[model samples]
Every structure is written in structure tokens, then in C-alpha cells.
Target chain A: MSGATSRATTARDAHRTAHVVGRVLGVGVSLGVLVIVVGLVLMLLRHPGYTTGQVPLHALIGRHARFPVGIEGLVRALRHGSAAGVVLLGVVVILASPIVGAIVAAGGFLAARDLRIGVIALVVVLILLVATVAL
Target chain B: MPITPLLFILVLVLVAAVAGLLGSLVGLGGGVIVVPVLTLVFHVDIRLAVGASLVTVIATSATGASRLLRRDLVHLRLALFLAVATTLGAITGALVSRHVPTRVLFVLFAAVLGYSAVAMLRRRPEAAPRAGHSDAVANALGLNASAPVGEGGQVVHFEVRRSILGLVAMYGAGVVSALLGIGSGALNVPTMDVLMGVPLKVASATSSFMIGLTAAASAAIYLSRGQIDPLIAAPIAIGVLGGATLGARLLTSVNAVVVQRLFIVVLAVVAIEMLQKGFA
Candidate 1:
């Protein structure tokens, strides 16, 4: 009877481990997808073919278009633009990310009623946003 | 040609990693590390170096802030209120940077470094502790006027007036960040921790949280100048993030005294370099 119970406990623990591993992988995959999608979208938005005039990417959208964009063209345009709009747009993105990160974290906390974790996630999101911009 | 083959990527990553490690350990940013290296070692233009360095300061702040936020170490209420002032100050600073000569900016940078060294040397006298959320005081200092935030954990209260001083200090920090591309950690941490009576941990976290936004505000100006090099900023960001994670892990449960001493020495050297830049 004891031996049988131990086996059952081991099986339950294994199942829990597998579940956690899946969750971690899921989060990682989701973040990766988000980064890629954002990169692709920005690239399309700043495509050489997409120019409205001599404005280019930085002039049209903001300095965010110059944020390395995982491609060379966006960076080039950002480094070459001569408008105040670039700075204005960058300020907007810079200000917005933390709010977005906080709201998401707040929602998660509300769902779980775990304010501690929520605060932590909020901070994390802010940091990640800054890290992305600095990059 | 061929987008420069990202040759600077690995070098910048390594540089940023080192900066993050030292910055965390010594409470400074990779800017102190990146600026000289970019101009001296990598042969980047000085203007571009400054521009890229400013962007990385924002990155380091964002990375460290996130980790601290997770632990709920940041005084969100205080940070938000002060952020309003700091943001305004930062915008003003960026605008001012256009008017200041690079040589004068270097002199100003050196003065800030000297101030930080003096601050580090003086020990704070233990004083009567104060409340973090005094409604009257908070309102007077503009804390109550800030966007309210909710964070779970023990509601640690501190005095409000000092926090306002910290915000003012950050304004100076913002100017330095905009002018020099060096993150104002040297200034921000001391201001928040020592003057404001915030705990070292919270001060560090809050400073990290503030730096990025401040830097981002200034970086907008640089971006308009067409100076930010994606090749430099991208690698530095990724590298610093990874390196800071490792550094933070290593930092847990270590004696910080030695680190502080080393930081003073390094700052002094950097200060001398700034003086030279000014004179040059």
C-alpha cells in the first residue's frame, strides 16, 4: 500500500513539472513572436516604397522608426532625418510602453488578486521597454 | 555595404555587458564605459558616440527597473510624482543641450562626478524616520498630484519634502544624461537614497526606472540629429540586459563596501578624463 502511494505521488509531481515547463515555453514563445511581429510591422511601415515625400520614416512616424528595426533601412533613415517630429514620436513611445506594461501587469494582478506579483510584472515590463529602446 | 555586416554588434555587446556588470556593481551605467571605448577603441564619431551612449543609458535603466519593480522595491507613488518633474526637467535639459558648448557640457559633467564622489564619501546620519504617505506633505510636494499607482506589499511610508529634492536632483541628472550620454545613476541613486531617506534598494530601483524615460526624452533630440547608430545601440542593449541579469545574481548577499570604494576611484578617473575633454 505504501509503495503504491509513493508511485502515485511521483506521477503527480512529474505532471506538475511538465505543466510548468509548458507554461515557461509558452511565455517565451509568445514574447519571441511579439518581438518578431513588431519588427516586421515596423519594417513594413518604414519601407523605402512607403515614403509620403522626402519625409522618410523618421519624418513621417517618429524617432521610433529608427530604433534599429532589426533591419538596416529604418536605422539609416532615423540617423538621417532632420525634423523635431522624430523626438516627439520617440517621447510618445517612451512614455507609452511603461503604461502598457503597468496596465497588463495590473490586469494580471486583478485576475489573480496577487498585488505583489502584479507590481513585479509592472516593473519588469517597464524595464523591458527601456531595454528595447536603448537597444 | 551589406549593412556594415553588423561588425560592431559583438564588440558593442561585450562592451555593454561589461558596462552593465560594473554599473550594477559600482552603481554607474555603461555610458561611462561605452563613450570612451566607442570614440577611442571603436573609432566611432564623438557625436555618434554620445548619441548611442544616451540611448544605452535608457536601456540600462529599463532593464534594471523591471527587475526591481518585480520585487516591489520601487516606491511607485513617489516615483510617479517625481517623474512628472523629472520629465519636464529632462525635456528642458535636452533643449538646453543644444545651446551649451560640448566643452562646457564636459565641465558640467565633471562637476556632477565630483559631487557624486563627495556624496559617497559622506555618511548619512541616522535620523528620525518619516512616513511615506503623508497626505498633507505629499500634496504640498506635488506627490499627491501625481498619477496614483497601486503596488502590493507592505505600504512603506517616507517623507515627501525630501523626495521633491530628489526630483530636483534628477533634473540635474537628466541634463547630464542628455548632454553626455552617461546615465545619471551616480547622481540619481545618491539623491534618492541619501537625501530623500529612501532605502538603498528602492533608491537604486527607482533611479533605474527613471533613467530610461529621461534618456528616451533626450534621445529624441539626438535621433532628430541623425546620430543614433542602430548597429551600436542594438548590441549594447541586448548585451547589457544579459550582463545585468548575471551581475544582479552575483550581487546578492555580497559586501557592498568594497564595491563602493572601487566606484569612487573609477569616478575620479572618469572625472579627470572629462576635465581633459573640457580643456581639449
Candidate 2:
């Protein structure tokens, strides 16, 4: 990668790898989506009724699924490969992406000696954690 | 007539795909379309629909970010700074959502949608200010960015004007995202374009980057409340992810102005219907 391939040394070059943020975000969500795909396929096979059966809109989605929360929830879900567990695991993965992304960005900024943005990134991470854990 | 689970998933997939496509074309998250369709057409509770839409929003964002983040289109400093405010707003929004009267919420959301429709119809603005020389705040935070335009990259010299207002608007955007389950691009893009003076593509890209993070912050609240239906969210996520990937690829080739106008028309109709529903 020639320096001249890009012009300004803006936020893009703040990290050693411009694409690290992409890979981090992409991998996290894609992995989650993949689990959902498998879980859906399994769901259809296990209960063929889902293919053609219908329920009232409220009855179908009004009640949230019985999924675990926080670290214990994640651990319990991962330990079991049941269809429900797999689906919950997918949800867990999606929920963790931003927290993970902030960590990556903060680390990158710190590595590049840009403390201002690094601290800002750290604050976002902390805020997300508080929201996730408290709310 | 009642809908079956199989039929429901198929319908959701179809709607989410269309939403994703249009959203990517216009640089918004597909949730703006998804939430209304799910609530009005499917007769789902607004909260449940919002929960489902949030998942699709994250999926749509993540798929696009995999490409855009590397293209140098995303302004990370801007996105993260905004996220600080937005995430706090999201948490509060989720907490207060059930308390907000549904009718009032509808009226408020409709107003936001109406405003966005008008903004979308306006002509595109000029490129961002000359690059290289950054203001004190901008340089200190590494907000100055560049995008690859024409042959070489163009340094987008942008000074974030109205810093407090921008943060406040982002907070409102986050609140709306959590409350209505829309991506809230209706506010973010405009705030960046009109207030901050970032280039259009850069603003859109940054907004797109922030969507996942914003949704993630809010999704946890919904999850803890037992509002997210995995069965409903999973298929929609799959479809939106697919559609957004296609839409992102078509972005450069398509005439964005035409698409923007068409989307505004559709949004206007939805807003009207939602207002009536609120009154009813």
C-alpha cells in the first residue's frame, strides 16, 4: 500500500490496518447470522408446522423468547447446542459487536498515539456496557 | 385471517429485503420501512415490531460496513463522538418508551419522518470544506477525514460546527431509534450534512457505520425487557443483510436523487397513515 494511494492522514490511517474495524464488525455479525441460519433450518425441520402454520401477529411476537442475559446467559447458551440455545447464541453475538468494535478502535487509536480519540472510544465502550448491563 | 409462522417468515423476508434495498440506496437503515409495515400491515405491537426491526438494522449495517469501512468512506472519529451521545439517549429512550403514550409517540415519530422526507427532496450540497487545515477541536479529535473521489483521494476539510447541537440531535436520533426501532438516519445524515458540513457520501457512510453501534446499545435494553423475538428477527436479519449487500453495490451506479425522491414519497405516505393510526 503506497502512501500516495490515499491523500490525507485522517481517521482512516489512525489504525495500522484501515480494514481492521471492518473485519472485526463483519466477523462478529456474520458469525451470528450464520448461527441464525442454522437454527432456522433446524427449526423448520424439527417443526414442519412453521413452514405453513400461521399465528396472530400479537400472539406470534408479543412475547419475547426465553433467552438468558449477560455473561451467564452467554455461557449457558453456548454450552447447549439445542435449537433454542443456538438462536440465543446468535442474538448474543449480535449484541456484543459494538462493545467489541469500541475495544478494537480504542486499542488502535492508543497504538497510533492518538490519546484523544482513544479516550473517546473508551468512553463509548463504557457507556455501551452500562446500557447493556444496567438496562 | 391469522398468519401462519411459515407464511409470516416469508412475508417478513420479502418486506425486509425491499426495505434493505431502498435503505441502502438512500443511505438509511431498512428499519424505517420495516417498523411501519410490521405494525400496520402485520398488526404487531409497536414494541415487538421495533424489536424485530432493530435486529434487521444491525444486520443491514454490518453487511455494508464490511465494505464501506475499508473504502475510507467512514469517518470513525465523527461516528464515535456521536455514538457517545446517541448511546446514552438510546438507554433513556428504552427506559421511557413504555411510559410514552403510544398516540403521542406516533405523532412525534410522524413529525420526524415528515421532516426527513422534505430534507431528502432538497438538492445535494457542495463538497466539504477544503482539506488539510483542521480547526482546533477537529484536529484534536482527529475528525478531519478523506474519501477516494475521482482519481485520488480528496481530503475532506470539515469543521464540526454547532458541536453541542450536533450531539443533542444525535441524542434525539438515538432516542428515536430506540423508541421507534428505526435506524434514525432521518436525523443523523441531515445533522452531519446541514450542521457539520460533511460531504454527502461521507455523512451517509458515517451514519451507516454508527447504525450498528447505536442499535447494539439499544438492542440490549430490548433484550433485557424480553421484547426481541428471535424467530421474528432472524429471518428478517438474513433478508436485510442480503438486500443491503446488493443495494450497496448498486449505489454508485444508481441515480441517487431519483431514488431519494421516490423514498420521500413512500415515507410521506407512511407518515400520514401512522398519524391517522395514532389519532384512531
DockQ of each: 0.04, 0.44
Poorest 10 consecutive residues of model 1 chain B by lDDT? Answer: B141-150
Give the per-residue lDDT of model 1 (tens digit) for B48-129: 6777777667655665665555444555445544555555555566667667786786677677777777777774543333
Please write out the lDDT profile of model 1 over residues A1-135, one tens digit for every residue: 001112122323322322332233224323432443354345435543433233342332233434433223344435665222232234234333444434443454434444443454455455434433543
Q: Candidate 2 chain B, which ten residues in sequence have the lowest lDDT sum? A: B126-135
What proportion of the true contacts does each candidate reproduce?
A: 0.01, 0.50
lDDT of 1 at A18: 23
- Model 1 Cα interface RMS deviation (Å): 15.3
Task: Give me the overall lDDT of model 2.
Answer: 0.75
Two-chain DockQ for model 1: 0.04
Q: For candidate 1, what is the recovered fraction of reference interface contacts?
A: 0.01
TM-score of chain B of each: 0.79, 0.90
Q: What is the C-alpha RMSD of each candidate to the true structure, in Å?
A: 12.2, 3.6
